[model samples]
Target: MKQVTEKFRFGIDIGGTGIKAGVVSTENQILGQAYVPTGAERSWQEVVPDIVHAAEEALKDAGEFMENCISVGIGCPGTIDAQTGTVVYSNNLNWQNVPLAQELHRTFTQPVFISNDANCAALGEVCAGAAKGFQNVFMLTLGTGVGSGIIINGRIFEGGGPGGAEFGHTLLVEDGELCTCGRRGCLESYASATALIRQAKRTAKQAPNSLLCTLCKGDLSRMDGRIPFQAARQGDEAGQRVIREYIKHLAAGIANAVNIFRPQAVLLSGGISKEGTYLTDPLTALVAEEVFGKKNSFLPQIRAAELGNTAGMIGAANLSQ
Candidate 1:
């Protein structure tokens, strides 16, 4: 086996819109990166070749050859069978039962590893970003939808199967809003940026005279996560209401996760996390109040993810290490 600190690694992050690849050093440094648009409508056979092209570009940019890489790691969205390096399903890419690692291995002839994209993000943070010293960490990403990653003893924990730590899909309300996963009242339905935008639009509609309506110039479609937070900062009643409720649901989910895993820290990522202390302060208070063992047990520290968009690729690259 090669020492992790003595070799270069290739990391690939597959997303709905694009595929990002990076040549990373053993020191967790990204030497070079490249990206290609994902023609998701095309077959995986076509997509796989594009992925290879992107990797070659990254290696070239890093002034290295494929032979210099010790292994390749892939972070993809879906139920990933890490042991088999297969992607069982990915609604965004319309991929199902794809032998992703095997496909990559055929092209690169290197050891290949695969994992959930969110899990990769958590691992990235743990290895090189915010959770560096923590043995246990939980990460939440509030994007178009909510995504979660859990790390225990510095390793990704996928529960008993391929898809675990799916905090976003956890039920928050009984038969409430419909979720993208065909479930009702999942945490994503209430705590995600999508949910924030929805709440902002509905709030503006209900209170036509509120500042939230004016912020979007009365076009609900123009409303976004920032608008509500901005409006709330300006003392808008409707905006404050929207943010408050959003926090409530988000806190509930965080508390639930804390109660179960009790990690050393909980890191927040994605667009909403940019709110910084405005979001964290309130969230910390709420979680302290709601977490099951808050009064008697040590509480996990909550903070924002430091790596931003690079976490997935960086984490993927380190997987082989």
Candidate 2:
């Protein structure tokens, strides 16, 4: 393995709302942290400089000169060509084949690496989190939609160009709810926080006398996870239905992952995952039932991600090795 300290690596995580950059040590400790709004309205040309500025700020915060840095890595949300360091497409950024790595190299005068956000999260897991001691792991991020990363033998296996792991898009039902990826019956159609919210809204609309309806103030559009979860705790049948179905869909996805990768662990992140055992415990039981793998202790253990929002950048920095 390349020595992490032989050269400091800079990591930049460009999210839908903000950009986080930092100087990270080989041991996976963040030496410095800095942030800036993503400013979605700005074009990539305008965005590149903002990323550069964030990197510069991180270097300064770490009391390190630019010359000491080995490489700069970016974990971007998009379909990326990791081999070429190009953004093939991004739903949120609306960027296409933006040569972010090339642009960063031109601006910061250092080698730059870029990868899909899900892959970056997996890298973060292997580098510093639950998978640190293991070379193979799966990271499932339960956010507005589901995202996944597969780390095999300490490296991300990108299928062809920019694809890492897209568990969310896998079809679970025939002609289910439409997905942002333009697909129907995607796992995300039933399991994502957005999906949960949609379920809640429909239930709220029908159960006008329910507490969820009161929480949403009779507005279906305003119904969301918080209200549903609250209603579930308050023993509302509609909330219970939403949560149970969401868990089932999520479990099905995890079980599929287990059968495919046989990873050392399955890590979860994002706000929805914060539901904790309410999700993990049952998901584990479902995996035991659904996964085709041997009923042995070798089954992947599911856990929550420790790095939170910064996991992407942390994983990106470790890519320098």
Candidate 3:
């Protein structure tokens, strides 16, 4: 087996709108990278060629040949059969049972490993980011939707079959908000950046004279997740309310995960995590309060993700290890 620090790997991250590829040292350093639009509306067969092209471009940027890399690893959004290297379902890409790894392997002529994008992010963080020293970690990305990944004993934990770690889809409130997954009151419906933006818009409408309204120029279209946090910092009542509620909901979701997994660390990623201590400080306190065994057992450390967008590619590259 090749040592993690001694080899290069080709990594690809497949998203709804774009595909990002990187030539990453197994130790988590990115030597070169490339990006291309996903064109998800097209067929999976059409997209596979672009995926290969992106990898070729990244290798070119790194001034390396494809044969130099030990393997090709991919982080894709959707239900994946990792053992078979298949994408079973991907609503974002409109794909079903696509043999992703098989297609890429034919071009790269090497081992190909595939996993959910969020799972890859978690592994990347464990390899070289926020959860570097920990063996058990749970990560939640509060983006357009809440993306989650679980790592147990330094390996991605995918419950049992075709990608079962759907932490974002976990129930939060009973019949409260409709989620993108056609469910009601999911964690994503409450704790995501989209949910935060929606909360800010609601606050703006109810309190037209509040700082939130002023910040958005009285046009709700301009409201975003940051406006609430920004308003809270400036001592705005409505902004503070929005952030407070957002934290409460997010804490509930984090607390639920902690109670179940008892990971050593829980990381926050995506745009909302930029709030830093403003988000983590209060959220950690609330999660501690709500999690089971608060009085007698240890609680996980909740912190912001360090890698941002690069975590997925880096984690993907390390999958072969």
Q: Evaluate model 1: give its TM-score.
A: 0.96
Candidate 2 per-residue C-alpha lDDT over 126-203 given as tens digits, one digit per residue, 9 for 90 to 100: 888767787888887777888878888888767754554677788888898899889998988888788888888887
Comparing candidate 1 with candidate 3, which one achieves the higher lDDT? 3
TM-scores vs. true structure, each candidate: 0.96, 0.93, 0.95
Candidate 2 vs candidate 3, lDDT winner: 3
> Which ranking of candidates, highest TM-score first?
1, 3, 2
List, residue by residue over 106-170, the lDDT tens digit for candidate 3: 78778999999999999999999999989999999899889898999999987789858999999
Deviation of model 1 at 53, angstroms: 1.0
Residue-level lDDT tens digits of model 1 in 1-321: 122323588889999999999988888888888999989999998999999999998877787767788889899997888888999889889999999888887888888999899999999999889998898999999999999999988888877777766889999999989999999999999998999998899889999999999999968899988999999999999999999999999999999999889999999999999999999999999999998867567788899999988899888987853
Number of the predicted model whose lDDT against the real structure is largest: 3
How accurate locally, in lDDT, is each candidate?
A: 0.89, 0.82, 0.90
Quick one: RMSD of model 3? 2.8
Clashing pairs in 1: none
- Whole-model lDDT, candidate 1? 0.89
